[model samples]
Target: MQLSGLAPGDWVTVQARFTPQAAFLVAADGRTRTYAEGEQRITRLARALRQLGIGRGDRVALLAVDSPEYVEVLLACMKLGATYVALNFRLSPAEIRTVLAASGAQVIFHSARYQEIVDGCRLRDAIQFESGYEEFLAGGPDGGELPAVTNDDDILSISFTSGTTGTPKGVLQSQRMIKAITQSGVLELGLRPGDLIYSGAPLFHAAGFGHVLYGVARGGASVIMPQWDADLALSWLGSGRVRHATLVPSMIIQLLEHPELAEADFSGLRSIMYGGAPMPTSVVRRMADVFGCDLHNGFGAGTEAGGQLVLRPEDHRRALAGDEWLLGTIGRPAFGCDVRLLDPDGAEVPDGAVGVIASRGDTVMSGYLDRPDLTARAVRDGWFVAGDLAWKDQEGFLHLAGRADEMIIRGGENVYPVEIEDVLGGHAAVAEIAVVGEPDPHWGQVVTAVVALRDGHGTPSAAEVKEHCRGRLASYKVPQRIVVVANFPRNPAGKIDKLRLRELLAEGRIS
Candidate 1:
């Protein structure tokens, strides 16, 4: 099924069950954009693209906030077998240049807000989103069916990971690969037709766009938030239509703290999904009680290939009943991925023994764009070793230890930073926190906690937080250094930037 020729003209030749009820997108303002209207727009866009020399198999990169237009362009590209590349708006123009250059995109459709950026990139050609969007749609070929001969193995996208190391890798997505993950994820979310699932997460990231597919697969409605906004998100949740949501732990903290949270009508909500990292157990308990909705939190290594594990709602409910330990476990291998817990020798370890979490599936990328050596190291024995350290229990739920690279080797004893972080995160004054390895002349690498505190609260000193962790974590696991900041630098997906944290340490600001 490996595709060599993927162009819109080709995919249109294939006949499959086309769902006419496909609602392309529903805006936050309650506008229903239909698939038929969207398809017409796509044809014009394809025609306009063709005029601009954007051909089959070409890359049409999008660098803008989420909207109905973004989805239209994506559908148009799909019609032509053109791979739609969604660029992260959070990245600096220079960082974006790296992606566009690496992607070899000929035409980039962007927002006017980024006019200066488009000018800075000095791209050979470009189109403004607001101005060109409608023009491209209305002017492209008054065409008959274009092409959509793409197959199951056709490459769909080149999604980049928001790495803590700052070296993002483009993980390729395939048609068949995502089909399986989306179906399963939709089921896990318990979405039904017309179920309003508000996704404020970045669409450029897997959680953002992938969730859209999950919603569509289940015949549900997905409401994109463009970016995270606590007040706006709460408005949607209280709007009575929104019945489901997926969030990162940090967002959960903000939502629960919002004043409206106390009175917000969450009666419509049946399930809530959380990931991108573990939420503090304290927050989880409060969410369960306050929202009166089932909390389904799980862990996964997200790459272009897709999600590796899911803590399904049923499993979470079962664990909440008695297996409280499952709160710390990442759950079992997902349907789409072949997971493994391997020791240094790449051999399987017994249940409860720590090892590296790895996965293999068609969803796994062919390779990181232009990083074959790195890809080789990652995809050994046909598995993408996610570089996350974890273990499986006898019941098969996975317990995340930490990032293998981030592990602090103290006097030869490895310590996980997550354990210390979970302890510090429980404090009332703390809003969000990340632990990173800092240079130490004695221990080789000492653990440091970089914290962002709750508003109107005084910052906790290093010693103050160490005392808090002392009771819950091992003595060696307590942070030796604490750095206070208003906010941590985040990638598009909202994961804190540890590389920037290292710079803060080198400047003697924290350590």
Candidate 2:
């Protein structure tokens, strides 16, 4: 039977029964578990959770890094028909309190490292992963039946936004959404059984959680990295055991800069999957040259929607063949998704016209938890829109035009920062660049470029950077002001914090 037809929680049983002894998890610290062992532990954990008074529809929260225990807790929630809430570990105490208060989680599991923080949250029961977690798991009776997963629409997890623009909203992730994403990854992204995968991203984020689940969903093994380390990752990649891996642009950049790039044996590596932010074209090309493997880039998949658009490996090959415009696109609609560019009136926009993205699919979240008003505004009919803007090319590929909220209206003309940033980022001296609109007296808003130059490259004056964009972009689209910086401020989600950047500039922190 297809895994798509079953609840995501049942995927473990399918793999465990069929693949039994196959490795399900391999931690960076040398911890390992086979499918049978993982299933047994998950079953016990489900019963243990029941003993703690957590049942159907109840919420269980986790505040920790990526680990096998994290994966087990998520599965345990699924087995009991409970909702798992993965909170960001990087959040401050106040922010953490805000999320906990909103989520109303019955129990929170934290690592020893976060015991102090969890104590401040004042939960009724805060189980430490290493200290009390094992004891808690052992408390369950050996042979008890878990709840049946009957409803596909049941909330499986609550994923919070990165809070770049404002307070984080809890996006309800359903079992159906997880199943859809799992099927999409297996069919569209070529995830296969027996493929040893490595995903070091934080489990709180969708990509991190999805990558970890994909391995179990496909009867493969996932190599867990508690946190990303370039040196440790390069060694894992060279082991000739890891077939698939998930990384972000920043992680890839660090891996490229590592001295082992030239010596690492990636012969067994089949694909490199990256997402969460835009990748510089230069870095993309360098990664392709160094890794010599299939490159997959996911685009437009947020907490609300699991998988929407994907730039497949073949798309990267085409870009290498001089179809450079393809690199700017996020590829076509993903499997089982309907992606449309719509005007304000909800009508589909014509090709080549910039419009807001509206997606409808099984992968779309059920709704925002406890915010029906906001949910109504975000999801109309069956389509979900989150203010992301893009234009469809003639070949049906979509090129991002920045977020609708991030668009700059310069002198009444709309200017997308992505177009300008892409041109400036290709310059040899620039390592990373961000374009934002600054408040202006006459023009209402002026385009400003914040750039971080590569090492050994002398700083280019504002005029020189502007000159590079002269013919490549229209005069209105060109940046009106330039500010150089050593690095950018990143939000908890690892995305460049443009909102914070604007704040810093207004305060005269960056010149």
Clashing residue pairs in candidate 2 are none
Q: Point to the candidate with the largest TM-score.
A: 2
TM-score of each model, in listed order: 0.90, 0.97
* Per-residue accuracy of model 1 over 1-511 as CA lDDT, tens digit each: 1122434222212211254455646787778765555556666777777777766567878888887777667766666567778888888788888877888777788888888877776566787878877766677768666666467666677777765675778777666666655655665666776576776676777778777766554555677655688888887787677778888877888898898787788788787888776566677778888777877764665554467777776776776688666677777777667888899999998988989988888667766777888888888867888778887877788888888878888767788877777778888887888888877888888888888888788878767776787667877778877778877777677777667777877887764
lDDT of each: 0.72, 0.85
Return the lDDT, model 1, position 446: 80
Q: Candidate 2 residues 1-511, lDDT tens each?
A: 3875677777777788888899998999767899989888898998888888988899999999878999999998988889999999888878988898899896999888887778777577888898898999999778744545647878989988889899899999888888887778777757788889887567888877787778878888888888878888999987788998888776787788787787888888899888766677888899888888999888765588877898999999999889987877888888889999999999999999999999999889999989999999999998999898999988899998989889999999999988887788888887778899999999999999898777789777767867887788998887777788987898765678999999999999998
lDDT of 1 at 43: 66
Candidate 1 segments whose C-alpha is farther than 4 A from its true place: 1-23, 122-124, 143-147, 455-471
Off by over 4 Å in 2: 144-147
